[model samples]
Target: MTTERAYRYRFYPTPEQATLLARTFGCVRFVWNAVLRYRTDAFYQRQEKIGYHDASAFLTQLKKQSDTAFLTEVSSVPLQQCLRHQQTAFKHFFAKRARYPHFKSKKHRQSATFASSAFSYRNGQITLAKCREPLNIRWSRDLPSAPSTVTVSKDRAGRYFISCLCKVDTEALPITPKMVGIDLGLKDLFVTSEGQRVNNPRHTARYARKLARAQRQLSRKQKGSNNRAKARLKVAKCHAKIADTRRDHLHQLTRQIVNDNQVIAAESLQVKHLVKNRHLSKAISDVGWGELVRQLEYKAAWAGRQFIQIDRWYPSSKRCHGCGFVQEALPLDVRVWDCPSCGTQGIDRDLNAARNILHAGTALLAGAESCSKYRGALGN
Candidate 1:
């Protein structure tokens, strides 16, 4: 099957390239914030909707004006692309898939997207518009094919990265008889139906002291001073380290799971709601359950594995997988329990929940009754 994949690599830009990219980033941010404001005001003040074409026209008029003519200095592709992105963001908001579009800030990570017309790729090298030399990229891995689009971004840590979106052909993995269910948690990253538990690395906690120290140092530095800027960079580096470690671990874990299982079942957790509890919010966020599941889903698709997410309210933890007995309550502290109706002793809570998830997911894949009807018919 053919799939579009993004491969990202770190690069050290030349002095000239860095200067040009900074301007490009600033231009892109300016365009996005300006267009978003225009659209927002049009809707609220005049009851007028500004579509992409109208926004594009507005950009053209803005560029020609003497006051904003500096926009014409950089390549226009990324500016135009930003408008398209804004349009998509608005679409997602109206469809309830995402929140309203927000103005881009210069302080955060900045990126510019270059479509095929705006860049040239040849012999494993990429040259962006208005640049004479190809980017000096560390070829971590070769692209499967030439990229359809390239996105260059600089994170808060002052590190540069380029992401290439390429079309690649993937062959499905060999069919396997193994199947497993996953239960995600804060203490243990995940427990499998097969009785395997993966320990949560707690990446953020590992760097907690360092991060705290850096943050404290940043707080002590006077605002708008060079010392403060340096201190802030130190803090950003600490955060980057934590995020990098967490992302790497999740990738490895999900890849292993997808490779071992033909059918993967997991609970569809409402992470947004789950994080609202102040007591466990930090632990929950650190565990990266949502990111893990997201990786599992996409990796499963790539490997031709069956991935299933049972409903969030399916009561996987409360239901006894062995006898279909439902418990009135199962508190977070209760890690082990006995099934009263079946007289099953010493059921591991996470494992049992994984098993129940597997059962429910299999039933769903078989086109069985709805969750409500299934609950009603339990133990029958």
Candidate 2:
């Protein structure tokens, strides 16, 4: 089967290359903000939405203006891609999939995309338009095919990376009969129906003190000063470290789960709402439940496994797996519960929920057409 994948690598640019890339990043950000502002004003004034083509056409007029003539210094590919991205952002906003587009900030990470036409890869080196030397990319692994698109980004910590998106032929793994359900929680990363518990690494909590110290030092520095800039990078590095650790943990866990199970079931958690609780918000965010679910979904799909998400309000925690008895009100503190209807006692809530999820997913797969509306089946 053909699978699309992104390969990312850290690249060290020469001083001259860095200067050029920085300029490119600035131009990309500027174009994004400019197009977004124009789109917003046009929509409000004329009640009309313009797309990428319209934005691209507007760029010609923008370049004719004295103030924006310098925009031609960088390769036009990245700027055009920026406009395409803004168009997509607005499309998503109009479709209710995301919030309204916002202006890009120079303080944050900056990225630009180079389509196949804008870059060439030859002899283990990548050369982009308007650049003399090829990019010094550390090829950690070999690519199976020429990338369709390449994106270059520089983070707040001053690290540069290139991500290439390519499609490759992959052999699907043999289907497994073992099916399992997963219940996610802050205490434990996840509990499987098969009585397995994966501990939450709590990356953010582990580095909380270090991050706080860095932030405090940052706050003490004067704004726009060199010291403040250094402090900001330190803070960014701390946040990046925590995120990297969490992502690595989730990827490992999801890979193992997907490889072992043919059908993987999980709860459809409304994490945005769940994180609203002031008491548990920190823990909830630290566990990265949403990221875990997202990883599980894509990994399972790639591995030819079934990934199913039951309804968010399916009462996975309240229902008894043994007796199918559901308590009207099960408080968050009640980790161990006894099913009064069937006299089943000492049931671990998370484990029971996992098993219930497994059962529901199996039932839905077996009877998709006749499945009840209450237990919605979301699978890929």
Stretches of candidate 2 off by over 4 Å are: 369-380
C-alpha lDDT values of all predictions: 0.92, 0.88
- TM-score to true structure, per model: 0.98, 0.96
What would the per-residue lDDT of candidate 2 be over residues 1-380, giving only the tens digit for each residue? Answer: 89899999999999998999999999898888888888889999999888788899888888889999989999999998888788788889989999998898999999999999899988778898888999998999988789989999999889999999989887667988999999988888889999999887778878989999999999999998999999999999999898888888888888988888899999888999989999999999889989989998888778788998987768888888876777899998999989898899899999999998898888878766432543444320
Q: How much is the lDDT of residue 287 in candidate 2?
A: 90
Model 2 earns a TM-score of 0.96
Error of 1 at 45 (Å): 1.6
**Candidate 2: deviation at residue 357, Å?**
0.5
How many collisions per candidate?
A: 0, 0
